[model samples]
Target: MDSISFQQYICNLDPTSLPRVVKICSGVYFQGSVYEILGSECCLSTGDLMKIVDVQLQKVTCENMENGHMFDLPQDFKGLFQPIPETPGGTQKKPFSLNPFSTQSKTAEFCGRLYSLQEVLRSAAVRQKRLSCLEIGRSEFQLYPVYKVKAIMHFRNGVVKIDSTLDVEVVDVTEESRDVYFIKPLMLSEVLLSDHRLPVEAEILEAPELPIAFQSDWVSCLSKGCRVHIHSKGSSRQILASSQQGKKGACHYFLLSSSYKGTFRRCPRKFSSTTELALSLGPARKLQVVVTKDHNSSEEMPLFTVGDRLRVLSLARADNPSGMDMLVCCRDNGEEEEEEEQVRLPLFLEAGFVEDLRDNKKYTLSEVVQELQLPCEVKVVPKDAADPLGSVSILRLEAQIKEHCLLVSLANEPSLAFEIPPKWMDVPLFFTEGSEKPSPPTSCSKVEELSEAFYYHLLKLLPSNVPPPPRPPKRRDSKLNNCPEKPGERKTSAAEISKPPFRESKSQESAKTGARQDSLRYPNQYTIQYGPQRPPKPTKPCFQVTGTSASDDSDHDYEELCEEVQKTVHKLQRASIKH
Candidate 1:
């Protein structure tokens, strides 16, 4: 076994070099033996193996060998750097990071571009304005000296605010590529929601972390490595049920399945069933029950009629009833104003009473959600019951309307076919092949929500890149902690200090930020960040009024501070007019 220290192993790897599996030699040598795999926390035991898929430079603690000063920078710092030249002595190569900033190994960035230390030293601008400005001109001069010369490293495991870089260990990012993820296997819910493409045949890669305790045919589908098809996007509408007999008795005899065969009548609207008559014409919205046949237990009973309409008035102050164990139906004659004339039905009567419904118009799927109660009879209507490509009775809707779902079934098997609910034990498979390539939905989610195991598995099948987040902002309190590394070489005037930092794309402006004016307000490309939504923060002012006055912020140069603004403006105006 080729064993190496954790740092050595990481330093020797890059995006293209991974995913290499490495075993822990000892728990004590690692940073806290506990590991949080893709947000699911678990312990990493000694001798246990983990794959290092990619490396990110979260922060680089750069130590200026010449000045012996140190500071930390995020992996996306945009300042230029030039490698410290050899002491007029030897030769050794170095490394560089290509993310956010594309600085080369050992050699630094200057004048918004990479330059050798000798090249920087040879510039006439560097010799005259070295102490005041970093805006090294190709030929023309600009203001501001290099404020930062540190490296930033980002690692995949740490997920959060881009401005914070990443909360990962300080690692040399050059050893790793700027791309890749450290993820885990798919969750059952993710697999279910993945039917982005309808009718995708899915093979479960892992068993769910939470077991489905309820026993059903679907329970068998939850096993690892089992293949299932993701058919449709489930409906979010609710299906309410009231079982007067019990849970078992209330469920209709028809099973909701693809292979089921059944016939269903349209809900009646005209002189329909007994219950329909009562509700439509009753004074209290009571359901009217019609006597199906004529019979009497007593001789004193009135002459039995084959078609008798008896009004069951007060199902009571009760408005809507569902899933009840018992029903009390009280009836009243239209002419009888007396309570004594009211007839109440026995709860345990052995007689069979059937449900009656009035005809409703042909309902669209959307109409059903807005208008009717489910478990009320419906046709299992397939959108395309006979497509040679196979019937697509269901549509996988990932659009805006996912709030509440209505159960859908085939019109052919209104009883046998059903719509899949948005959540709960739904059609086992969803999403499209559960593609590992991060879609808009998955990529927008916080990194903690991703499954590392599943991500890698998907990568092997269909490889793609996860969009990198915008660089994190510098820490606010960083100024309190870090001081200038080369104070003597980087003195600035009050005029320069008042010049606000430009809001332009730092990466894009790496070479031309010196030309940016304080008034420039370029809109950055909108990038999504993790965490809750917040109102847009206001733009930074040219200068804030702080308690500590800036009498002499940087070393004072009276001649430079008092330089004629008009002279520079005249030069610019003349140059523009000539051009």
Candidate 2:
């Protein structure tokens, strides 16, 4: 392993062949100064070893042929992805020009089967005419490998689908993989490579004393030869974390292991706009977008006013009348009942729109499968108003609502996603667009990294973590229960034993209270007021309790009514006595 310059080392390095460790040789200098980019040391530290996990192809600088201006296109910028052609024109083989034609394909597809060129020539009654279309006889046309290849071409007119035979160059869309050149995003990753991370398992050869806390036994365990898996997210040269080998949790911050030598995986970057997400996912359906702030009407911007709502319907269309890539959006009709108007604006719209907030209507995750479409814009809202989703705005659920669990990611940040069970974390959401049925989310990403704060929030809300409510103190036993002098002797009479010591209340006389208690003992003998009684409440539907809503709040009203009735009875008695 000869030490080479970082730029030279990764010059020809393929992104597919990543996770390579390159030890910083002596001090790599940038004009006698340390090279730092994005808070990451650019391999300038002396003796610092780093893992080049992955490199994401973000923007490709391409010189425009029309104006010679440098423009950048994102890696997933709907550039090109087509299938292989029947005949591949190798570089050595020249294509046909005006009045001049190249050799047709050697093989011909006939009756759903492939035939040799010689067999087709022999069967079709070969002719020597240089006609663009091959014809044997009248009403008989065999496959001449002519310009019958279907192609989709764009020009002043809208999209035109036809075979490339009308004196036109055979524009095969299948050559994007080989013909198109992709500029490498950075010195680390390759173009159009599947996601690959270097999850390395390394043993701590030498441990730094300051990284791990002294209070925990983990500090002692961070000794030489201690096996630990390094969770180095992203290709940052600085040490991120280390944990017990084979375990994903109970991690400790570890910097400069004794002899750590392993490559690192770069964390996926976050996407900021709905258009970017829609472009990544071809033919995205139900992508719901919410306007976070009001945008004033301007000539450059779409006709978006303060209160108007916008719904992105499709990806940026290059076939606009203005020739610019315009994002296709549906503008909600303001107060007036008008049909949704189509709006086309620049793809890189600088409007204040927050992703993930769907329609204003709120729905729990339980209703997702039955009620919502996939990839809808939404914000995770607490069932109670007091609890808030701090720093968390609207969330985009770009994936499917699972059978038991669902993942919701930040609308603005697509890379960071968290999974929560529908049971405990079934959050309600209002659509950001202020519509009835909300569109889906913009991001095509599934679950990614779960936020540590959100994880702790869920854990705290778990039934095991929450303590039960305190039970009311048990009623104290009465100390005034009378007992016979001699338990073994004759028992007291029933009347004496049954009698309870009575005290006159300040509001009532002793004789009257005793008589009232005696009358209460014989409920039938108690005097009944035969005064005018209010009629029983009507058994109307409004009075009837339906569904699960509680009617217990009305108990106070019932108590007040009872008090009013008692007051009337007492006033009547007083008036009769005075009279």
Candidate 3:
């Protein structure tokens, strides 16, 4: 292609059209600098002037014409991404108003977002009583808080760029209540447009959205105790702690959620810088004063003291009331809930039974012991437990008792008594101090000497009249004889034994005749009688039989006789047969 067509092709070619073009080629300058284009290569060299000597199908090589050195380049090179130039309004010579109400916005692309040009200009505007200028190299230019947006530039590679204002604010130099000025507020100056080092979305690296005023629970500096709320250039969930203090004596700190844990640094140039995180400076607190004029009016004096706390009626009214109004009852309602739940439980007012720890038995209280029993549920408090006083939780069984609550220290030789509230009885009690129960008296005399008195008293509640049920003696190394180990010798061997003839015994013959006579005389009517009896021993081998008959035989002995006769005949037949 001719030079004209080649230039046209380069202009029409979109670098970002190819998603594979991720790495960016270096040597492209943001300032006015010329780049060399060879036959098939585009040489990008960082210098005032560079001369291209060779070109390849996929590679571009160039030598620094100023230094006269051969250039070594890599393949798959891409053009650099530069920031778009300012819009027409930025280049105009007209002075813009500092008033915020006069701000206007024109639709334009900023940080890849479609923003109004006038809105960005207004954001970049800073109001100050005195003018400030910035020095870059040898050139000096007046600074403005905000600048007008001129245009949006779209590169062939899908990268977009725009000129936006950097946000700044003024803050107090000291914690004192006097109006003092140490430095001028940050002012907006020239527009900064630069190419990113890598191929990345410009919008992604832009500063976060910032609130107008920074808020916090409380921010404390490590070096000083002064608490200050810092605003953000852009809203970010990152808390910034400066290693170095600002021009003013105050250290800049911003509030962020507890979730964020990262380092924060201010960006020196454009707020869109990728390496630097953009943040807003805190605003100065202004107090309105009513100046009284003298006859000359040369010097006006304010009536209010500088140190007085300034409160906005709107804010004061909103916050003057204590936060306690927003709080629910801080006192625990657990006691009320406990009372309701305890109502379902049964009262233990009946004759009390003492659990014998030694025997692991419970015995009923005898009348003698019951007569002396106090109307209280006594629980033994073990030693070395949570209760230092070694007190037991006692609930009075008798409502008539003046002292409904009592404490008997288990640790003492003589149990001591501490009075607790009767309300404690409505719930499962713990000996914690407070509420109706105060801390147990520190001194021993403060408590009654009921110590082991109640312990023994409770032991007295056990029935001394009723004897304990007897238990069988434990057999040592005793096991039931399941089977005999010895084998008995047979009376006769198989060859010597003779087989007996099958014959019915006289008892069986008589039983058959009786059954036949009974069946003929009367129909059988069986009546079953059953009752509980002690289990039989292993050796006794007792069993039961039940049946229905139309006979009048109710005698237990007659039934046993019938069963015995049947067994005898079966045994005889078995003995007659050969083994």
Q: For this target, which candidate reaches the highest TM-score against the unseen true structure?
A: 1
What's model 1's lDDT at 25? 56
Better of 2 and 3 by TM-score: 2
Q: Residue-wise lDDT of candidate 2 within 1-579, one digit each (tens)?
A: 344433323322344544444444543242224443334332133443334444432233433223444444343333221111233563322222211122344323323333333333222212111111122111222222222111111110111222212221111122232332211111011101224332223333344333222232333444555443221222211111222222343422222211222212111122354335344333434544556545444444555644456666654433433333455678766546777788765543444554444345555443532354433444445444433222223443333212232333333343333332334222222112221321233432221233344334433443441223223222323221232245455433333443589776766787788778644432221111122334544532222111233356754454454455556656767877999
lDDT of 1 by residue, 205-240 (tens): 445444232223334445555654433454332222
lDDT of 2 at 518: 47
Clashes per candidate, residues 3 or more apart or on different chains = 59, 17, 33
Worst 10 residues of 2 by lDDT: 183-192
For every model shown, what is its TM-score relative to the native structure?
0.30, 0.20, 0.12
lDDT of model number 1: 0.34
- Candidate 1 least-lDDT 10 residues: 441-450
Candidate 3, which ten residues in sequence have the lowest lDDT sum? 273-282
> Each candidate: what lDDT?
0.34, 0.35, 0.24
